[model samples]
Target: MSGHSLENLASFVRDLDSACSALMIEGKNLFAGSHEGVLRCWDSATGDLRWSVEVAGPISGFAVDNNRVYTTASDSLHAIDMSSGELLWSRELEGGSDYVKASNGFVWATSSVYELEVADFIEATIWRFNENGDELERWIITERPWYFDLHKDGGALLGLGRPRCGYLKIQPGEKPSHHQLQTESPVTSGCRSSEDCFLLGHADGTISSIGSDILSDSDSNSLVTDIASLDLELISGHDDGSIRMNGTQHQILGSIDSVTLLDKDGWASSWNGSDTQITILGDTTNTISHNARIRQMHSSDERLVIGDELGRLFFLEAEIVKRRRSEIGELDDDENKNSEIRARLRMLRNR
Candidate 1:
């Protein structure tokens, strides 16, 4: 496949003052959070700045619902009106907020503090909140979670470390349940692969699925950084600059930071942190280079939003990229034809 520049094919581009730390795409709105504590909403179609809001610290993560955008910045969680970008409420969380998710009309967040004595995070807390910012319930666990995701049945799935190197399940209005799986390493990334299965990637480059018998070993010793699924096919990114699809590894130029399935046709994007580029994998592989390392990426259908460490935001349409690739292929073919004609003329002169 031929390589093409992403900047030439992007639908629009925007800039921020600091590194872009978080990104969320909902409907026609694009929400971007920066390391300098600024969250801005943009019109995904036209690249117009709809609104911008400031928080207390660097934005850690974001979760969006029908009417509100939930954000975790430093040790606080802030709720902002989705339409107006107004600060609805803010609440301080114990330890520090690391991840947040929203499902079934409720918001969930996790926080943890590192202990110098133990050289690790000893305790972690999970908080559940209503739309009005009222805390409905909270749970405390012995070890901090290394990964968190929403369960298929509107609960929280937490992958832990150390003493309890398994998973914890938290349902609404119920006690937390711990399930210790027989594994060689801690879970680093996970996602819902199907209606009845949850795929978890391990630090030792193994993949395990809950409620299913699917197990895969990528054979690479590097940590699995991210996992995504398209139908029954599992795609995983590794720290060794490789991406595995059902145990088939494809090596790229740099360590993989994240991997996400773009559509039903098995189109996927894997971010290469060392090269500061995104490799789109499908029938033909193409790369999109960036000015700085990508911090976050989110996609909806054919549209993609990328945020970089230099605080630049790029909105891309997959259709445009496909067209660009075709053009580059045509150009290469023409060059080859021209070279062949020149060679024939030189042979005639020599004869």
Candidate 2:
């Protein structure tokens, strides 16, 4: 421990084959889902599994408010009670919906692949639903929706489409508007809000702001896999243990405060982009595998919730630990000699 403490909240884990599509932090409870089509919730303090709700098809999207949780799978949407895990209602549409975002008193979603008896056709539709799970209005678009971020105060919506395909801005009741601030390269991860606009981390290791700042670069491939913003600072974690922070103006500010290891070569952090620099509170790196990548981290500027590709979820605080001596060069004489020879051979392999 680095003389720092984590928020010590509990976390829920869902084992998925590819990646997690939906995560909602409802009060102290965390709701998450996977392609397995199950909604898993856990206590945020002890990592205890509280409840699991099974659904049809794969859970493609989720959004939550004070009293209800809404999720979409295949061609249908479901409404569930947050307290008792009760099914409130479900709506099956002509097509399956994939991405969802919540704002104000309404829930918005986009659907492609309208199901037909003879053949399925791709149709992009955006639906707005009231708080009571009632459809209010619908709009059609030419492009499929990759993801949606809500901007309540700004009265605008940002939608991510196929990689480098750019984004569409939808007003309260208007047709979708296209923006050219996107690349053909895939976006690894992104986060959007009404307050801070939208941020995207690309497959080429570059990070760009979509709404206001149009700055983009191909060489700054920081290999960013996840991104989060708080108090005008952006924090992103890479494939390596490296994390970077940038200001709202899109300038690199600092780095990860620390890195902690989990059991399976994974690491977690609770830093929420509070300070000018990133902070890491606890580490299990010495005991876990180094090949593990922190897939998704959810936190405010104060606490952190992290998950890795291995489906391990942990809650950590934002604090820094002192660097420890690496064990790579600490072998005995005979073993060290053999390791040196192998190391040289490995270097030659890269050439």
Candidate 3:
């Protein structure tokens, strides 16, 4: 650990994987689905290869639930068992499935909108499926949904696109309700921070929070620093750990080019332009540099994992940066309490 600590914990480079494509971090297991059509899982504890499997090429999306890993490549959706890495099911979708989400007993997929050759127009399809592999409903969206996140409290799903953005609320045994949000410049990325509040990244280098209140000046601003100057959303990372966006556990903001998540120590790196600098959300002075521009970024509790087009994966771990937060002090999430529980679970995995 570095002696010069920010807030409480010093952020340091933990490890690097020279070979990487699409990456996901679930608990202590880090999953990488490469453009080479290969998927790998590593034991984050020892940085050991837990299991590796070869799959079809150019994976566009990767996700995980309690039991399995869901992936999309080409127009196909594949589910692999979390423990054994065995293929449980695979299905093909119309057009090409560009994004996917699995949560609250349902799996969702969306296809790219623009024509394959020309980015001239937008037309896309969204598909929903149940655990038994039965197709529930498919809807068409005028603006493509490039990314999605499950509402933390459940009963709803969040979707993002350039021209439009919205959330679909699903009630038990009832039709889902969808609502559209207004945005100037394209809404490149979005994620639900809490039940009442969500954050969105816009193409003009801006991130905004949309909650029950529609007219709060504090809701929108150019907080992305260098990224704001270069309206790009290159890669995205999901909040699957203890890090809080903007110091609150529920607030998460994202752009299309780079994955942006906030925390007490600042933020995990996401990109807006060709630059390779990772900005700490509020602390613009502190940044970790990379040789290549970041194409994808993901996170665990303490680890920020990023992949570049150069086929390399870089990782940074902030020593629980939340420990140093002044006003908030420490993270109030269950991570501290769950550490004892996960320690016990780790023992089982070793066997």
Candidate 4:
């Protein structure tokens, strides 16, 4: 159990075909879907197959809660039991679905394809469901709304359009309202506000914070990719192969947080797009981490599990470190090692 080593937990059925589109984990097992139309479940810690099912389309999105595993294909959605892999309920949707988040007793999602094909019309929708697979409500807004934030408070939904453009707020039954907080550049990628505020990364390397009032303009051109807010600081992963800590109180850099590089097995080189996922613990200023390439990830207060594209999973115990020196000179013996770590981090962020 080295600090940075990945362990092979399990592999999916062969029909999954060496390409994992999305992955999810339940209590003690791992579930994955491939570019092919196979959904396979394996022991979370041992990589042993529990069950496999062939669906109508490629696996697009997945979520797990207790004994029930939920997923979305091109034209359909499914809920299956974890133990026996029995199909419990199946529903249908219009197009392809991309991401799904299960929390606060709901499954929230966005579309895999939101590009406009019709002359002047494109539809991106969010569907809500109950535990028993009943469709609760749905909303259609914008031409292509991808990433979303379903706030813990009620049913508040936050949607992002193409970058440099602004974002929207979707209340239960009200018309979607725009924030109009124009960006310095097109926002290439973004994540939900792990805290009360939100983070957006622009195409030109600008990272900004949006508060509740929607008029606050606090941003920096730091070339950041993914971010997580913790305590009173923002932990950001950058395209420059570095992770920095910025002060939320006065809006400035606190220090050059932690630096990490790609591992030896080409895990960092495999990242394809701006889809890396980062989550931070709200209580600690140093516990920020992420995973790329659609692997399963989970974080509690004490531990984290990162599953990779190669079907290897890494379990890490949390470590909180402080800035031991001033940020001024060239690499020392220890800083030289840290530089390599930062290089790997940048490659992941840029990809």
Candidate 5:
């Protein structure tokens, strides 16, 4: 364990009109979608704006392949050309599109309908389409899926809710199969660690694995809010403002909002009303606090991208972050300049 410190600050874009709701990083590009329905792409290395586009509604999620980016806005799924940011096609889905993933030359999306009278999601549908935006198949389920991941076989693995209380497996052009678990809590978050391994977290703070022999059951006594995996290591965030890495618990500032992996290290972000904290887990753990709440985060290789509630986007690199922390550690005892340095180290772009 290492002492927690605030240091890293990187390039940022602060012109968004609403909170950033979704983020994805691929290759040299960083993609962000906002609550105001604005989607923008930036060069991950230079922080230069590549393009921006407006869609039908607030962007909920995004999926990117080699040539296209697919996003779910309102009840419609929009496909945009990756390079030019031109709209290629848009298709309306019943209920509302909540999640989207692209793999193996195909796209998969999930939509759910909420029953206001019951105050819960009543049904959901899984849709599959080709790269050309043509629908191929769909399967409807009675329970809403709390989480889903794309399987290596080009199918969808869904963590289901009440009545099922387990998982569902949907293969391409085949009938859906399901296995019910005899548990009181539903799966809340999950991630595909490898081609053959999937880890799932439950509301009762239990962690389970499918197809992996290394993971064993662990309990945290709080709801698992998010999970991210790299190779064989697993990092999970909980509702109790704690993070578990391979069953080792680390305390943070607030309840965790999201967790992700930048290269081999695991990063978790949490919000406690006035500030947002981003903690890195590895050989030497570090945490950075920000003024704005982070809405979404994603990473690629050594680079990290963050979208915050104040509509700002930040880009940081692992080596640069370490270097910045080292620079901060050498500051002198001048109060006035130290005050300015602390402001800059908050990681918010000074406007």
Candidate 6:
């Protein structure tokens, strides 16, 4: 490549009409979904739009496994056949979100709900489903969901709630278990830490980690505890660039735009739109910033892809900088444009 210049840029797909939100890479296909109800899969090697499908409503959060794509909209969840672009199944569930994951032979989703039609406080529920689109179970907990993900073994799920940080562990065919952590603030988002524990972003622009042992009760369904459990401790947190506001502010900053775990090693990444900062979760001291406001962060293999509010697509080689980032722990504040730091990154455009 030309030293991270525009020459090595892969390819790009952009639309002035659709606001892109999610990105994924499956095999040689790079996929993106937008608010315009369009979902397209592009060939990673060629940057060609291999296939695209448009549905009735905007696509929020969705996952593709084998030949099926599971998606969630504002009021429903759907299972679609990727090959034919045909709707396989759809369910009417309120509070649909763009946050969905497929693991442990199941598709999982989260949504907010109220006890009554017009209640004030919000409570959220997490649902699990089999690949065939059958709803297995739902776990309703104390607060609105701020974060959710499956454990490493896929045997269990973790959810962190907000207003009051209510944490719960949900396993198939068992009562959801709850755990207490030191964080008592509103949780904005979370992901698995480098150590397999969990990272939770606070409204105050801080990030913290919870030990894996706290999730020990994850698989209560098993007569004997699952071997996936590991003894760990709470990794302290630091200011990850969240700016504190007074009683009144736009309230957009400090919230999580997207989260992805680095594949090569122990690095976990999340984008905070509030201050336009990308934190290497466990190593919160150093962060990255994009020229524009970032709306999503995703990865497949060694490439890290980003989508922004301007309907632009970008791509970077994550593994190239992984070794250097880990060794330095925290990069110097003025190193972003440093020639040595820009070597392995490239952007992809979607026109």
The number of the candidate with the highest lDDT is 5
Name model 5 segments beyond 4 Å from true: 1-8, 11-15, 181-184, 329-351
List per-prediction Cα lDDT, in the order shown: 0.78, 0.55, 0.55, 0.50, 0.79, 0.54
Decreasing TM-score order of the candidates: 5, 1, 3, 6, 2, 4
Please give, for residues 8-111, the per-residue lDDT of candidate 3 as tens digits: 23231222223355777788777776676777777665556677666666777787876788888776888888888888888888776677778856887777
Supply every candidate's count of residue pairs whose N, Cα or C atoms clash at under 3 angstroms.
0, 21, 8, 11, 0, 10
Model 2 RMSD in Å is: 11.6
List, residue by residue over 261-317, the lDDT tens digit for candidate 4: 111100111122543332232233222223435344433343344544543334433
Highest TM-score against the true fold, candidate: 5
> By summed lDDT, which 10 consecutive residues of candidate 3 come out lowest?
226-235
- Model 6 C-alpha lDDT per residue in residues 1-351, reported as the tens digit of each score: 112221123233344236676667777767677776677776676665566776645567777777887777666777878766677887766564535778645888877665566564366667888888788898776677666767765645454545546467777788987776654555555656454577665544344456643322111111110011112222221233222111111112243344444442222222354445444433333455544566566665666666766555555555445444545333344544552333332222332
The 10 consecutive residues of candidate 4 with the worst lDDT sum are 261-270
Better of 3 and 4 by lDDT: 3
Write down the worst ten-residue block by lDDT for model 2: 2-11
| Model 6 segments more than 4 A misplaced | 1-11, 14-16, 114-121, 152-156, 194-196, 204-206, 212-292, 318-351
Clashing residue pairs for model 6: 11-349, 12-349, 12-350, 13-349, 13-350, 13-351, 14-350, 14-351, 61-98, 253-274
Angstrom error of the Cα, residue 320, model 1: value is 1.9
- lDDT of model 4 at residue 128? 73
Could you tell me the TM-score of candidate 5? Answer: 0.87
Clashing pairs in 5: none
Q: Each candidate's TM vs. the true structure?
A: 0.86, 0.63, 0.67, 0.59, 0.87, 0.64
Q: Is candidate 3 or candidate 6 better by TM-score?
A: 3
The clash number for model 6 is 10
> What's the residue-level lDDT of 172 in candidate 4?
59
Question: Candidate 1: where are CA atoms >4 Å away?
Answer: 1-3, 264-274, 329-351
